[model samples]
Target chain A: MADTTTGQSLGAERTTEIQDAYMAMTRTKRMYGGIMLIVFIALMVSGFMLADSRNAGGFWDGILNIFNFPGEVLKEAGEKITLLPALMVKFFPSLVETINIAAASTLIGGLLAIVLSLLSTRGLARFPRLIGVFRRLMDILRAIPEIVVALVLIFVLGGGPVPAMIAIALHTAGALGKLFSEINENASLKPLEGLESTGATWSQRMLLGVVPQVAPNWLSYALLRFEINIRASAILGFVGSGGIGYDLKNAFSWGQGRYDEVAAIFILLFLTIVFFDQLSSHYRNKLVGKA
Target chain B: MTATAETLPITDLKQSATALIGRKRLLAFATPVVIAAYFVYLFFAFDIPGLVDRARMDNAAILVADSYSYKTHVTHDNRGGGLGFAIEGENKGTYPEGMLPEFVTRTGEDAVDIALKAGESATIEGSTLRYTRPDYGTVTVAVEGRDIILDTPDGTVPDWISASGARVNITGAGGRAVVTRARTEVYRYSMGWELFWFTLDSPFYGKSFGELAGLAFSGERVVADKSNLAAMVHDFWNNAMWRHKDVIWAIFETVLMAFLGTMGAALIALPLAFLAARNFTRLMSVRFAVRRFFDFVRGVDGLIWTIILSRAFGPGPMTGALAILITDSGSFGKMFSEALENVDDKQIEGVTSTGAKPLQRYRFGVIPQVTPVFLSQILYYLESNTRSATVIGAITGGGIGLLLTQAIITQKDWEEVSYYIVLVILMVIAMDWFSGWLRGKLIGRSE
Candidate 1:
């Protein structure tokens, strides 16, 4: 009876020690969390103040006038509602050019991405030693913003769809290459090993064995990239190239008198973006779901 | 199924199998053919053949060469009767009085001798400029009256030398010389960026790295009020030609735009996502309305948002940030709702069983369950928004993109353009690494 009582007391003492340690750890964690939250809030507040100071119009002032431009646009566009169709129709070719830029770049970039991803994949690379080189190349390609390339190319090639296409394509290749390589890593190596045993070349193995397994995922990613590239192409056009975005820019800068044209371009752009977003998402869901 | 197939005709199965294979094979062949045909159509549509005609090879050459090298102008005004030395013919890069490039020597009161690479020499005497090529002998150009005259060693201008009545231009491998009625100029091409560290006015300009290091620690003051290192840094930061301070500020503003936009979007979208999530909200109308709002904002796209916001906020990083915030809130709303819907109801039920209130239950159950997903999405967007911020900055007129556009617009600032490109790339890579690190720290690496 005496020994049992002593053992119970000892166990209680140990429990108390553990509870104290747990409380200390929890306190430290809470302190860290609080500190982090304070830091984050401070950063956000200061950043806002800095941005506000640098802005040509202060946030409070701008917020009140936020709806002014849109209201004017809508009113003017409403006044010329009958001309909306003609305006959209007139800009349709430019819209098509924008789509073409996106599509062609996606096609070209997707193809290049396939080759790059294949070459960079560990077990599937033709020259395994050069995988790092290919990866770094993709990183660089990805790091460069499309606008930089488009602007530079505009200097060389003059303003057109070609520069925009090339710029978007280069970016797409880098982006898709990274995603595709990730997909490649998850693929079963058994197929590759079997193909190797069958005396298949690297290209043949990749095409016959790996491509079959990853094609759907790759296609889905490419489709998503295509959606992104469409927006990118339009933006590039607005910057200097040729497309609906260029038309939008012209209409937008023309100000009040051309608000109808601006609204028409806006509608066209919005519709196209929505259409592609839905279509690509639908296809992507199917592809990923089937897989 | 095999038994039924066996009960059926074997030839019928074989025919069906053959047809299936044929169709698959045809699809395999047709896909590439269709792609090729589309490309061919695109070639015509994009005017690929005419692109060659439209392409300016000379401009390309100038861009490539000018990006890596700079030329020093040794100019003499015929009427003004004075020699001036400037880098790239820019007023800011003008050499101080009594100062000249190391390769230039004052031969007379109004003349100088320029020694170029490979035993090439040019001497300016009064209004005449004489350029001596190693093997081709000396070519002289003199501005006499309104008409400029060129005299080659052989008394005939070669293909490289283009002489008109009003001007004479002699292009040589070493340098280029042009004689006009108003002035005569000689351009000496050299490798590397000039005045990159310090402008022409700085006392520390043209100091070697070792010499700079020595001076930095030697207790010597380049300027009266500051130490050598401080003075050096001040000069480098305030470099007029490169504008390093402005460039750095631009980069900081870009990152600020991205950070503010991404975090602000996440903050705005969180509550809306709960309304849209099927598991969280009971009313269908609320969910539908929230979801449609998300779609509308997303479908309007960043370009449209940038345009509208710029009009309201004017040209600055604030506009770019707001544009990013508006566009990404839509994306975050959709993604967060999906994530919220995927959360396990058991956790919420467990919290409620503990006699927790609705807010307490959500805090304990829902937030924890979706925090990881929300964090991952926000971090991913943070990195991407940096790139978008650059593009938006271009449209909104702020950040490094604005600087880049301005530089490019100048057409002569290719070197600055190249510098900005490098810095932009580095900034992006740094952001990528940082976001990745933060993601790993917060949620652990998914891969």
Candidate 2:
């Protein structure tokens, strides 16, 4: 009876020791987290201040006046509501051009990305030794912002949709290459091995074996990239490449009298983006859901 | 009856298999055809032929050459009777009276000798300029009254020389010389960016690295008020031509905008996400409204947001930050809600079983579970938003993008444009690496 009581006391002592050690650990973790949070908050606040001081307009003042421009645009747009449809129609060709740029670039970039991703993937690489080179090449391509390329091309090619298309294509290739390669990593290699045993060529193996496995996911990603490219094309236009954004810039720069046209373009852009966003998301969900 | 049923099932399986294969085959061929057709349509629609015609190959060549090489202009003003040496003909790069490029030497009050590349030489004396090339012989240009005269050895002007009544231009393999009524200017091309370290006004301008190092360590200060190193740093930072200080600040502002926008959005969306989550919110109407709000904001897109915000805020990083914040809040809200819905119910139930209040339960259960996922997503967006910020900055007139656009617009500053491009690329890559590293440290590389 005495020994049993001693054993119970020993159990209680070990449990207390364990509890104390756990509490100490938790306390240290909490303290470290607190320190990190404090540092982060400090950085954020100081960064905001520096940005504000450097900015042309103060944030507090700007916040109060945020709706002024929008209100004016809306009021003007409201007055000339009937012209909105005609203005949208007038800008429809430019919008189509923008969509075409996105589409053509996505197709071309998707093709390039497939080749690049296949070459970089570990199990599927034809020349495994050159995989790093291909990967770095993609990194450089990705690292270059599309506007940089578009602006330079604009200087060379003059204002046109081709430069925007080429710029967005290059960027899309790089971005999709990285993502597609990740997808390639998850793909099973059994098909490739089977093809290899059959004495199939590298291209043949890729087409017949690997592409079949990854095509749906690749298409889904390509669709998402298409949506992104549309936005990029529009932006490139605003910066002087050529699209609806160029038209928007023209109208916006004309100031107060043209707010109706601006509203029209805004609505068209918003609608197109939403339509594509919904379409791509729906398809993406279906593709991934099946997987 | 059993045999008939068995045969029917086998044949049905075979028919379905064949149909599937046929559909796949049709899709394979049709996809490429459609793509090719689309390309054909685009080729005509984008006016590829016109683009080829509109393309300025000369401009491309100039951009390529100017990005790496700089030209020094040696000018002799005929009317004013003044001579000046300038790099790229810019006032900021004007050479002091005593200092000139090694190949250029003053011969008389208004006369100068310029040594061009490949044994070509030019001399400006009085109102006459003479250029001698090994293969092209000698070309003399004289500015007289309002008319410029050109004389070649053969008395036959080659296509390389363009002469008019008021101006005579000689373009040779070595350099270019123009004699006009106002001034006689000779341009000599040299490799590499000049005045990148110090301008002519700085005392440290012509010193070699070794000499500069010695000056830095020497006790004798170059300037009376400051140390040599401090002066050097100050000159380099405030370099009028390159504006290194401004460039650095612009890069910082871009990153700051991105950080503020991304983190601010994540903070704003976290609570909103709980309300949007199906399990957390009971009111269907509330959930529908929130979801629709998220969609509406996201659909408006960053470009429109930037335009609208810049109109009110008037071109700055704050506007860019807010634009990103507003656009990304929608994304974060949707993504975070999805993440919240996927959270394990058992953990929340366990917290509640401990007699924890709603807030405490969330703190102990929900936050811990979602923190890693949320943090990774935020970091990813932070990196991406840095790039977006550069684009938005261009629209909003803030950050490195503003500098880049300004440089590109100048057209003559191709070297500066290239420099900015390099810096922007480096900044993006560095941000990418830093965010990836942080994400890895904070959360295991799940995404």
Candidate 3:
């Protein structure tokens, strides 16, 4: 009976602490919480209405047909072959081409970004206004989807992989430029200052001091973006840009009984992503000297 | 590498000028070259016009009219030989020539049983056989040209008759010919157990991914090449009907959907974040729980959230929106909470100590301090979500990406496909600007 009473007292004490904390809250906080709650409720309700997941099968099936159409074309190609061997085949040729295009864009974009970062960072601290502009520009660049960019460009440049690659590369440059600049800015400033004190030129100082510090981070970021590029390539493939995404789309679009094949390709893609992640993590750890 | 004043100060100055000239040369030559090179490559990388010609010749026009005349191809998945009759010419699709013919085909074959019309040729073989005009539906000859226009029963439309029957040979542009035969092929097989992941990661990878794949799977195809893959790309670039347009639409719609959805996520996240911050809230426990919940939502990827939304709503803008909302909830929640927590408490005290009501105190003290950060984070996410929207669209089948995939597979029109790719990148840029403007308005109060 005494133990039970003690337990009850402990529970009571806990409640008292909670209430004390609650009571201790300044009126400013309660008011904020109440208002925030109301806003939260409204958003949640509206979002529920907007994103409700009750009727998505038809849409999914429709898209599945589009993305996996390449697979369907290949299968319907009437190449008599062993089932197991065919199942293990990788991306259709066109999809592979898409990946190539996306990769090319990434390379071109990253290369350009290196230069942009140099200019942006050099001007950023000296002119705080430039920082705002640079930052805003990047935000704007990233806000628009690549697909939309492709559509507009299609009207201008005609349809093909070149416009797609240009769009992908441009966005890549924008994104990478910002990330590289941040790394440079966050890098150790002591070396650059030391070089400056030695009467080293600005370019010399940046090359000898700044570049070394940020190189590892840049490489890490680059590697990460490569993975993203692959996914982006798949996206481009959907738009007839060329790649395996179309194959996946075809596989999904045909009929209901072929989900197993769709699942297989999906698995391969997932595995590819996982493998890249593992490889990247390995390199990142080695670079950082993680034990 | 060193120039000295002893020889001549003027000379030294000139030498230094030369060094500057070298640097300028490096910048002037490289900068424009790089940008110009990119533009050049974007303009004439491969035969962009050839893709159009090919598409025009052997049209695989989408089923925009619910029915199409498909010239069967005998080519393998690699545009090689398959079992079906390769349409000898552009007698495959349902489009009119010089007027968007209801059907058009390049080299694929048709096996339709048709009643011969007077002075018309039945597209059966490779040569346009001469026929005498007998009557409205009497005389007929099978012709094999780059295109074969057949007079079907439905107002003399172009239709392929080899549904599961005879095969046709194609001879044109050598590689552009498609084989026509009844096809029951399924996509090439991929190893299973690769996609069963339940973790969060945004790490990078090196080229050693193959070693890992080989390790993970027992029966791995080392060389997955042209046979199954190439045909897909070719179809996507060259096919018009539904291939290019559909994927483009998917991508376009995805961008719009994501932009709208991110807006919703931010609207929900901002004020709640302030409340969730202990420094800004009256209830500590509520703040902690709400913050944790937000974290949980943010913990999952937008793709997973897409699946969840698909379950909640039919696949459309709703599913895509839900996915964006769930992912952005966590992002906005954390950003807003941090902004709220960082606000100067002195201001809050200044307002409240004067016996001001809770609402007035919050309005005067807290909102202003955090609005800038809130707006900036929202903008950044809006930009980021544009890319993320691609994935959401993929999950829901409501974006240009859907058509994009089809185009890549069926038409192989790489040039047109490139345009879609460009569109997405541009959209990301536009979002970046709008968000920045919003941030400036809320905080910097600058132009």
Candidate 4:
């Protein structure tokens, strides 16, 4: 009876010790979390201050006047609301050019991305030793902001839609290549092995066996990229390439009397983005859901 | 009875299969046809033919050449009767008196001999300039009374030599020489960026690598006030031609924008996600409103948001950050809420069974499950936002993008443009590696 009581007490003491250690760990973790939070807060505050000091206008002053430009634009647009439709019609072709740039880039970029992804993918790579080279190439291609390419091309090719198209296409290829390779990794190798056993060429195997498996995901990604490219192409246009964004910039620079045109372009952009955003999301949902 | 039922289902499947094949065939042919037609239309619309005519191959050649090479200008002022040597003929790049490159030698009081590449040589004597090329005989140019006279060995100039009553230009494989009534100049092209590490004024400007190493290790101070290494660093950092200090600051500012933007967006989106999540907010109206708000924000797009926020915050890193923050918040909100909805109910149930409060339950159960997903998304955006920040910086007149645009705008600073491009590429790749590393550390590597 005495030995049993002592053993029970010893077990009880060990359990209490473990409980104390767990509580201590929890407290230490909370302390670290608190410290991290404080540090993050400090960084944000200081960064904001530094940015404010470097700015042309103070944040507080600018915020107060923030609505001034937009309000003026809205007022003018409201007054000339009748002209808005005609302005939209005038800029519609430019908008079409922007869309075309996006579509063309997506098509071209998607094609290149397919080749690049296959080249970089482990089992699918034709020259596996050069996979690092291809991967780095894609990284560089993706790293280059479209504006950099567009601006440089503008210098070489002159201001036009082609520069923007090429820039967006190059970026899309790199961006999509990375994502596509990820999908390619998950693809079942059974079909690939079967095709290879039948003496199928690499391209044939990829086309017949692998492409079917990943097509849906690739298409879905390409559609999403198209939506993104549209926005990118528009922005590139603002930087001096040709599109509705260029028209918007012209109208914006004119100020006051041209607010109607700006408003029209803004409406078109907003509506188009929303429409494509919804459409792509809906299709992506169906595609992923079915899979 | 079983056979009939099975046959009926098999017939249905066969019919559907045939129909699907037919549709697929139609789509296969129609899609390409449509795409081809669109391309044909685009070819005309974009004016592919006219682009060829509009393209300036000469400008492209100059850009390509200038990006990798620099020229030293040797000039004799006809009016002032003075000799000047400069790199790219810029005032900042002018050599000090009595200081000249090795290729140029002062032969006499009023004469200098320039040793061009490939056995080509040029001599400047008072008002006369003579160039000798191995492939071509000597050509003499004289500036006299508001006119340039060119005397070739054959009395007939080749296509590479362009002469007018007022000016003469001799272009050869080795170098170029131009003589006008006002001045006579010879340009010697050489490989590599000129004075990249050190300028002419620095004590270590033209030192060999071995010498530099020795100086860095044990030599006396290069400057009177500082150590040799410090002086070297100071000179490199303050290099007037490259502006390394400014470039580094700009890079930092770009990263700052991305960090502030991504973190701020995540912080804002986390709470807003709860309101939009169907499982979290019991009120349907609140959820609908928040979801719609996210859609609206996302629809406006980053470009519009940038414009709007720049108006409010003015041009700087802060404006770019805010634009990124506002736009990405919508994305994060939608993604976060979806993640929230997909959370396993058992974890939350266990926490609730412990008599934990709602906040405690979320903190202990929901946050942990979603943290990895949230972190991965945030880090991915942080990488991409670096690139966006560059573009946004271009629009806002800040960061390396501004420097790049400015350099390109100058139309002659292709070297600087190339430099900026290299730096920007390196910055982006670094960010990519960094974010990937962080993601791997935070969440186990996927591959």
Candidate 5:
């Protein structure tokens, strides 16, 4: 008991020293952090002040004249800069359109991924060469960018979210393929063994064994890919694909005093994303048995 | 009687054989039916011909001829060839009236030329003045028989026209002029045509950054590109694309964004993972609720979150970032919580049974056992987060990927467009290497 008391005292003293050092370091960091915060706030305020509606309109007019073709929507984008009321109307619709593009791309991409992903799994020991071929093939597919896929498809289909959808689907397939294989290769062998012992065919054993084991993994990968697809869809719109991104680009190029609206949208977007992310996480946790 | 009973078995066996034959007939009929059904499934599901055609199309781009013309010039005794074309209509529904043509041909010496349209606003003076393309040769036109033969200053027949009715030749310059149809394709929109035979052509994606900034803030009604406008789809994923811009930005805000988004939640649900663990917090009720909660959160998916956010923010980088944040957080949390449940708890008991404070015991006892696992988990999330950051960036208004998106969609500049892809690949590679190094340092460290 005496020895134990002494040990506790020594530990306490060590803790005090560590605490002191930590506090000193924290104070130094706090000073720099405070300065950064102040500077950031100042910059934002100044930018907001410069972003006047009238100024934006004037800027828009200036930009439109340089566009050469007044009838073209993209050329007229400069004209749209700076009108607060009009900005609000156009901004909202474009945002809505962007969401639609993302959502649809994710679902369709996710479905295609499920089929391709199975090929990547190593559970099919009987088809080792096929597994290697598919795994490598998936890697090559995933290696291409969403934009590249979008651009190539655009050459074929012309324009629109269809290209974006293709990009998302290919990406989803590669990503989910890799993920599905990892899950399959790591699944519990006991269940698979039990099925095999019952004289079940290899396919039957796989269905009874690997399918249930990787079900949660499939759900997780699909959800994650959906999130990525959302972002990709929005981006494709910037290239004249006609989504909210098109509106945003026009707003930026017309660069009158509409910076505040951009900031406002940024804030709104952040809040909404945070909310949904929180919600999805809740389900992912349940699947991993970690909630 | 006993002998007769035994003999009765032979008669019964004959009846049984008849029954067996009836069953075989039914099975034979069913087998073909099943085979037919299987083939029908394969045909509809595979769609082999359609897929083959699609693949063929993907490999080659189509070129359409809009409008074309040619010109040739004749000098003293030589012939030269030249040509020109107009690939698109100027808002006149694929055909414009009384419009002048531009030349695609190169200039050569001899010059008597005819514009294919036949009627010219300006009259050509005979003999002295001649027409020629900058790159192609010139053409001489004489009424087929009226001025067909001519003597030059050298007293030789002038070879200023080609043998073919559709071609022209100039003899003095010693060259030929011919006009052929030029092919062009108008993608979904008719902004411009890539020069045929030029594979490097791609969409232009940039203007001045300042110009883009103006369009974003300006009140004027900003119009969108055709590709975007046509994508106004009524679907969940389409909706999410617009919404997730916010999430993308959020993901880029901090490296810790991935961890906190994922594992912080895991920390909060530590008790649940512990309960689910057979050797740890084994209370059935606690385990059940924790498991259920994980399912509920993870079930919905990150895209849904992105969609929801896009609606709220209207669309942009923030939505994409926010989507990343929420997604990473939820996933990391669940992953880490599972690791916790799976951790060794021998030391945990020593501290807990001794009545050490809960926080103290956790810090000193449970932490050591799971330190490697936790560190590895964090590192992996960070690596994955970096890739995710790009995805978020693409949708959001900011990030290098935005430049790439612009290139692919607008300018059609394929060569430089590949630069963006290289950058993304480099980024992912770097992240993988960095995480792997960190993994070694953290998880592979000596106890």
Candidate 6:
């Protein structure tokens, strides 16, 4: 009975020791986390101050006046609300041009992306030795911002939708190529081997064997890209290209009397973007779910 | 009866299969045909043939040539009767008096001989300029009174030479010379970026690499106030032509915008995500409102946000950061809520069983479970936002984008444009590599 009592005591002491060690560990961890949090907060504060100092207007001053421009715009838009419909109608052709730019670029870029993805994917490349070359080409294309290309092209070709289209298409090709190649890597290669055994050409094999399996995912990605391209096209137009954004810039730059036009454009752009966003998400969910 | 039923089902199956195959084949052909038709329509819509005429090939040629090569201008001011030599004819690139490039030799007080490539040499003396081409012999251009006269060995100006009474421009394989009544200018083209490290004012300018290395390591003070190495670095950093310091700062500002924007978005989105997540928030009204807010923010778009913020902030990196933050918060909110909804409940249950309070449960259970997903998404967005920040910067007037646009708008600064483009590309690639590395380090290599 004494020995049993002693054993129980010994077990209790060990449990207390273990608990103390665990508590110490937890304390150390919490202290480390606290220090990290403090450092992060410090970094964020300093960074914010630095950015604020570099800005043209002070943040505190700017914040107070944040609503001034919007208020003026809203007041003007409200007074000339009757002209909104007419302005929208006038900008409809510009909107169509913007959409066409997006659509054409998406289509062309999608096609190029397909070829690039196929050429760069491992175990499926038509020229295995050139896989790295194609991959690097995609990287370079992806790294270049669309504005750089658009501005350069605008210089040579003058300001137009074509420059925006070509610029967006090049970027999309690179962006989509990387994603498509990843999807290609996940696709089954057995069908490709079977096609090759049947003496099918490289293109024939890709079409008959590999493309069917990856088409749904590719289509989904392409749809998403189309939505992004629309935004890019509009932004490019603002920079100096032909589209609704150019009209909006003109209206906005006019400052006061043309706020109605700006308001109408903002409405149109907002609606179009939301519509495409919803449509593409719906299609993407359906594609991925069904697949 | 069994055999008949089986045969009937087989025939039905075969018919359906054949129909499916026929539809597939038709689609296969129709898709490409539709695309081709659209391309044909676009060809006319974009006016491809008209573009051929409208396109400025000379501007493109100049852009390409200027990006790779720089020209030295040897000019004599006829009105002032003084000679000056400058690189690219810019005041900043003017050579100091009595100091000239090896190719240029001062023969007299107002005369200098410029050695061009391919055995071509040009001597500018007062108002008269003489160019000697190995194959074309000698061409003399004199600016006398109001009329500029040009005389070639053949007495007939070739197509390469465009001469008028006021201005005479002679273009040759070696170099180009322009003689006007006000000034006679000779351009000698050279390869590579000149004065990239030091300007004419610096003593270290035009030093050979070996000499520079020797000076750097010898611990001598080239400039009185500073050591040779320090002076070299200071000169390089403050290079007026390259603007390296400003360029670096711009790059940093670009990255800072991305960093602040992405992290700020993630922080703001996290709490909002809890409200939006179906499993976390039981109130339907709250969830609906939050989701709609996310949609509204996203639908407004970054370009619109950038414009709005720039109006308020008056054009800076902060406005860009805010624009990115607002747009990305919408995206992060949606993605984070989805990730939260997908979190396994088992961990939460275990934490609850440990007698952990609600806040502790979340800290120990929910956050740890979703951290990897959160981190990976945030990192990915960080990389993408770097690119977006460049675009936004252009609109808001900050960062390297501002410099790039400024350079491009000048139309003559194609070299600077190319330089900025290369830097932007390198910055993006570096960001990509950094994000990938962080993703691997923080979340392991899932791929």
Residue A198 shift from truth in candidate 6, angstroms: 1.0
In candidate 2, which residue pairs get closer than 3 Å at backbone N, Cα or C atoms, i.e. clash? none
Give DockQ per model, in order: 0.86, 0.79, 0.10, 0.74, 0.06, 0.75
Q: What lDDT does each candidate get?
A: 0.93, 0.92, 0.55, 0.91, 0.49, 0.91
Chain B TM, cand. 1:
0.97
Top DockQ hit: 1
Each model's fraction of native contacts: 0.75, 0.69, 0.19, 0.68, 0.04, 0.69
lDDT of 3 by residue, A1-291 (tens): 999999999999999999888877866677876887898577656544443343354434544444344354346443433443356365444544565666678778787777667667753244555766766666555545566455445544455676577778777888898889877777778887788899988768767787767777887777777767766666555554555555555655555555445545554555555566567768887876777
The DockQ for candidate 1, computed on C-alphas, is: 0.86
lDDT of 6 by residue, A100-187 (tens): 8999999989999999999999999989999999999999989999999999999999877899999999999999999999999999
Off by over 4 Å in 3: A1-116, A119-173, A182-205, A212-291, B1-252, B281-285, B440-447
lDDT of 4 by residue, A133-235 (tens): 9999998899999998999889889888999999999999999999999999989999999999999999999998889899899999999999999999988
Candidate 3: tens digits of C-alpha lDDT, residues B273-311: 877987667898888889778856644334434543554
Write one digit per residue (lDDT tens) for candidate 1, span B203-247. Answer: 988889999999999976779989888898999999999999999
Q: Candidate 2: misplaced stretches above 4 Å? A: A1-13, B1-4
Candidate 4 residue pairs in backbone clash? none
RMSD of each: 1.7, 1.7, 21.5, 2.0, 17.6, 2.0
Better candidate by DockQ, 2 or 6: 2
| Per-residue accuracy of model 6 over B318-359 as CA lDDT, tens digit each | 888889999999999999999999999999999999999999
List, residue by residue over A154-273, the lDDT tens digit for candidate 2. 889999899999999999999999999999998899998899999999999999998988988998999899989988888888989788999999999999999999999999999999
- Which parts of model 6 have CA positions greater than 4 angstroms off? A1-28, B1-7
Minimum summed lDDT over a 10-residue window in model 6 chain A is located at A65-74
- Model 5, C-alpha of B169: deviation from truth (Å): 17
lDDT of 4 by residue, B339-403 (tens): 99999999999999999999999999899999999999999999999999999888877788788
Tens-place lDDT per residue, model 5, A1-291, is 999999999999999999999999989878876986687567544432332121213223433343332123333344554554565665676665556556555555555555455655665555666877877677656656566566656665555545665676777777677777777777888997888889888667766777777878777766666555555555566544556556555654555455545433433344444455655567777877873
Error of 1 at A118 (Å): 0.4
TM-score of chain A of 1: 0.97
Q: Best candidate per TM-score, number?
A: 1
**Model 1 alpha-carbon drift over 4 Å, by segment:** B1-13
True contacts kept of 4: 0.68
- Which is better, 2 or 3, measured by lDDT? 2
